[model samples]
Target chain A: MAHSEDVDHTSHGQSMGLLRVLGPAHVWALGVGIVLVGEYMGWNFAVGKGGAYAALIACWFAGVLYSCVAMIDSEVTSTVAAAGGQYTQAKHIIGPLMAFNVGLYLVFAYTMLEAGNAITLGFLVDTVAGMTGHEGGLDQRPFIVLAIMFLAWLNYRGVLATLTFNLVITAIAFSAIIVMFLATSPLLGAGEMLHKDLMSGQASLPYGWLGILAAMHFGLWYYLGIEGTTQAAEEVRSPARSLPFGTLAGIMTLLIAATLTWYVCSGLLPWEYLGDGVNGAVAPLFSAAQISGSNALVWLLGIGTLFATLASANGCINDASRAWFSMGRDHYLPAWFGAVHPVYRTPYRAIIFLVPIALIFALGAPLDQVITFSILSGLLGYTFMPINMIMFRKKWPLDTIKRGYEHPLHPLPAISLMALCSVTYFAVFLGYGTQLIAMIGFYIVVSLWFHFWRYRFVKRADQFTMPWPRPRGY
Target chain B: MMDTWNYIEYGAWALSALFGLLIVIDWIKIDTTYSEEALTSSREGELEAMTEKHRLEG
Candidate 1:
């Protein structure tokens, strides 16, 4: 098998290396950190479709699905222990073409999600000010741009600083959610909130089973970015052990957090009211604080909202840039993106490249559209995981690879996750319509660019070899 | 059908509890240490090898 020795291998004047400073704790923090803000918003929109009850049901299903997927992901990450998460795994299992597609999907997913967070952060700032009797909302464009640039700079600073920042903010975000639940769970009449009447009239399963289906994508918010934790595999200590522990622990934490948030928030306000409003995304937390009349808790929730957004965006910048770095290192992208900073020992160039794209999307796109695009792209990338799992098992065999953890159910988890993801993808396509089509168009353009341009670069550079079978005729 | 608000409530909590149990089991069972062979199999270790080879040749 040929390898990609075409990599420049120099960081200008200084050498390059990704510092291995992460442990299971840092990985867990990252896993939770990337997805924590989902509890803040995005998930609440499901209530509009399925009511609180149906949305809760969807959350439960998505939770189970995510838990299974996380376990399988842990197994793969433990074996490969590579950066770029799914892309790296897929490359070893399926070859470069598919890996390129998956890599692009992941980059799109993370970047779009980061942009979505920036937009949400803008909305959150407006909500915070509005609640404090400040009139009107702030323009979110400049704020989103500034936030993206700031996170880009932080990521350029290096992995330890980035992960440490993520860890501290994630801790604070987790605590705030718990405090919100505890403070409000007592004030609201749980019975009243969950009353059958809440689901009455036209709103009662408005779209029937389809409503539940539509809600699945929203429920995905709770665990959307946890898989990106695997991207940190290259930076972690004893990744074989830490990846599994971190990802599993993170999934479990998210499960409890999602359920508790659903329980507390669903009971605090009428499901209809919680599901309404222009700022519907953050309504649950906002309503919880408002109804409870706890100014301190409200402030805490606000601060938590801010930190959660920053943490998610910051973590995503780390993940997305690494994906770009890996591709660039392998010659799938311009070699410039592969450059590491001498001082920071981070992929400074890739991080810098990501900033402008993220800023453009953050400023130009609407939040709902960005969220849909992000989820769809992520789900498309995720469909490869199960296939990779089955392929990896066949190629490496359990006896050959030094796996840190193995899925007890083997192919079943992979099959189940694939089916669920397919269903969710179909539902998202149906619900989002034009946005999904645009995403498909985006994929086609990327694939074409790779075939006509990047593949030639790889071939010329003598790094085109892959472990898996190449795409036909290529 | 078991699709009521109560059903949703209990079901979510049940799944959460189940996940919590799995986490506890994993915490107890998962090994934190890596064997020397496993360490060598890591991406970082591979990079280190390449760097060393480059240095030796240069």
Candidate 2:
């Protein structure tokens, strides 16, 4: 059987490898930091879609989908043990054409998300300034630019420090959510939250099962980037142990956080206020705090919102640059992007290159459009997993290969993931039919571009680095 | 006192510009100092070349 584990290389010389400074804690921080921002704000938009009940259903549904994803990802990533996450999986399990597409998915998804988080960081600053009854609105551009450039600089310096910083802020943001739930626990006991009243009246599912499906779209916010933990596979001290623990732990954290967020927000906010329109929630948790009449809670939630946004942006920069750097290393893009800083042992060039691209995304696109693009790109990437899993097992059967962490109920997790993805894709279509089509066209064009021109630069035979036996038949 | 936020707004822009400039300078310096192969080639690349012939072709 072919054994798979990350080769821990001791430095023969001073300047050779990515510094394996990360532990499972850093891995958890990267995943949770990127996702806790959702609980602070965007997931509430699902309430706007199908009402509070629908949002709750969607949250749990999303939990199932992402749980399956984390399990399958742990299995594949533990074996692949590379930087690009799903992109690397696609390259080895599938082919170059699929890898190019999946690579674009990770790059675009994380880049757009980074941009969105930076943009939200600016908005958070604006909202805080507005709360103080400031004279005029600050230009969000400078704040957005500052956040992106600063995080990019952090990423360029080193991975260890960047993710350690993420750990601190992500934990703080997560704490605020827990505090919010506890603060409102009294109201729930006193029957003051009006949840029962609202559900009986209008807070019930308006669009029925269709609404729940629609809510699944925004429901994605709960754990959108938890899968990103796998992106740091190469840097982990022990990919075998850390990848499974961090990823599964990250998903579990998100599930708890998502449920608490839904419960608190639904109970606290009025039924009418919960899902006002197709585009819902300016800042739902902050709004919920205001309704609770606790200045302290409001401030805490506001600070939480800001920290979550910053953490998300920081994590996004870390992941996006890694994906881009891995692709460059494989010669999918210019080789310059593959360069590691001889001193810091970070992907300095890719980190710098993605700054302007993220800046463009942050400054130019509308938040809704940016978010939709990111989520759609992510959903498309999720679709590729089942195929990869099936192909992986077929290529190297269980008896022939030694996987680091083999997922149980092999075909079951893959099937559940595909079914969830199909539903989520439908949910996206219900709201963003036109955008969905456009995203497909965008990827199709990029795939063709890579196949025709970029393939020449890619060192095809050298790209397969895994030490495994040949396919069962081939 | 005038709204202090205005100062912060301007400072943010200045800081952003400075960071961008620094990254560019560092990028240029690194480019000048190292050859492309030196930057791109790593222990990982060496491993890829040594093992596992590319089976899943484009």
Candidate 3:
């Protein structure tokens, strides 16, 4: 008969499959994929509007949040070094069930995120088809389900398949953005740059700093995927070194790319010529095409947006599955979720579980609400990430595990991330009340109930270590 | 129109190729691996030891 220790150790071993799948380059790719998601999330929504500057400022605030969260993520992944990924890190300090609830929320966020991107893809396809004189229009729900299934098949096939698919498409997507810049720049002389509708009006000023801060929700939604590299910790070679470097490198590259892309596109056409009242997701790119009189440019943008949205789905599936696998490894979820395909050596169970649920969501849910809700949940999850990091340092003074990098101003980054997230959370509530209330209510109820249930699990296994003490040496 | 499009396409390709060459050259020139390799090995050793303890206890 095997000892309990033996069984537990064996369980942990299976979850450690993360290291086998990710490796250094794949880890870097995951980071790059994350930034690509962020760029799509932020860049797709606004272009050639008076609020473009305001939105850019909001994006910068999100960039600050990104830098801070990156630090917090590196610390957690290094210290915990568990397959549970984010949730495992939470459970180690808070309790198992709290971690489980976090996992639930994250899964919810990523699945709906697939739907969101699919919805965006749906619009891109419809517009392009309209431009080409294709009739009867592609049904969005069916297309969304198709996208979810296509991504599921890729992820289910293996990590290499998923990464290759994303890598090729993402490269094309980035190139399309560059092409958009070049083609659109000549349109500046065609019309007036500033339109009256660009302004939110002086009357809107009463909303004040609070209102401006609330805008962070949209910005935070854009920046949610920065720490995606850590999910593949076990797959990556030398995660301790690669995780921080890769995360920062990908983020910096995105910042440069996004800044250039936004500036070029926004400047090419005047704020007035672009539809001010319309919440055209890929409207700016289209307007640029319209002025340039280039059908090819519009086609280029349409294809790029579709690929970008697909890449988002592909990336989300990979990260979300890994989260479940990690949770299963930690014994917080069913054992099957942690199981690796003996041949593929991938978390096949988790992939299977995620795909069906994701398909259900894509087929059944409203696309707009799914996208916005995913953004809000992602922001909430990221906010929790830093808090977990701060707690880890306090309770477990693991000096040896500190990364090559640390936040320059310590608590300042943590505090800033929290404040930024808080603003976004409130704004999400204000802008999207029904979704926010439903999600938050779900989180609170689930968290409290899980706490009581997990108490028994804790008593049987790990002790409830109290508030952690501050370390003296830096 | 075809001629103009071709020129633009070729110009972009040339720029991309040049950038790729530069990146390769820079990678060859830079010594990214520090002597901290030794320090890293030792630190990893310590972590393994700690994880080993937790594994045994849990």
Top of the candidates by lDDT:
2
Clashing pairs in 2: none
Q: Give the range where candidate 1 chain A is weakest over 10 consecutive residues by summed lDDT.
A: A1-10
User: Candidate 1 clashing pairs?
Assistant: none
How would you encode candidate 3's per-residue C-alpha lDDT over A7-32 as one tens digit per residue? 45455542223324454556556656
lDDT of 1 by residue, B19-50 (tens): 43443343223212212122112122354345
lDDT digits (tens) for residues A181-220 of candidate 2 = 8888774433347678778654487777777878899889
lDDT of each: 0.75, 0.84, 0.60
Native contacts recovered by model 3: 0.00
- Arrange candidates by lDDT, descending: 2, 1, 3
Best by TM-score: 2
Fnat (0 to 1) per candidate: 0.00, 0.48, 0.00
Off by over 4 Å in 1: A1-15, A186-207, A277-281, A459-474, B1-45, B48-58
Query: What are the runs in model 2 whose C-alpha is more than 4 Å off?
Result: A1-15, A187-192, A276-280, B43-58
List model 1 lDDT by residue over A1-474, tens digit each.
111211223212223457778999889888899998888776888887677777888899899789887988999888666677888787667778888999898898999999999888777755555655554444455456556766776677779888898999999988888877766554642333443555567656666787888788788988999998998977897887899999999999999889988877776767667776354435577567777777787788778888989999998999999898878767788665665554456766677678778878888888777877788888887788888888888767776656889988888888889989877877787788788888889888988888887787763423322222333334
Whose DockQ is greatest here? 2
Off by over 4 Å in 3: A1-25, A34-50, A182-211, A269-283, A402-404, A454-474, B1-58
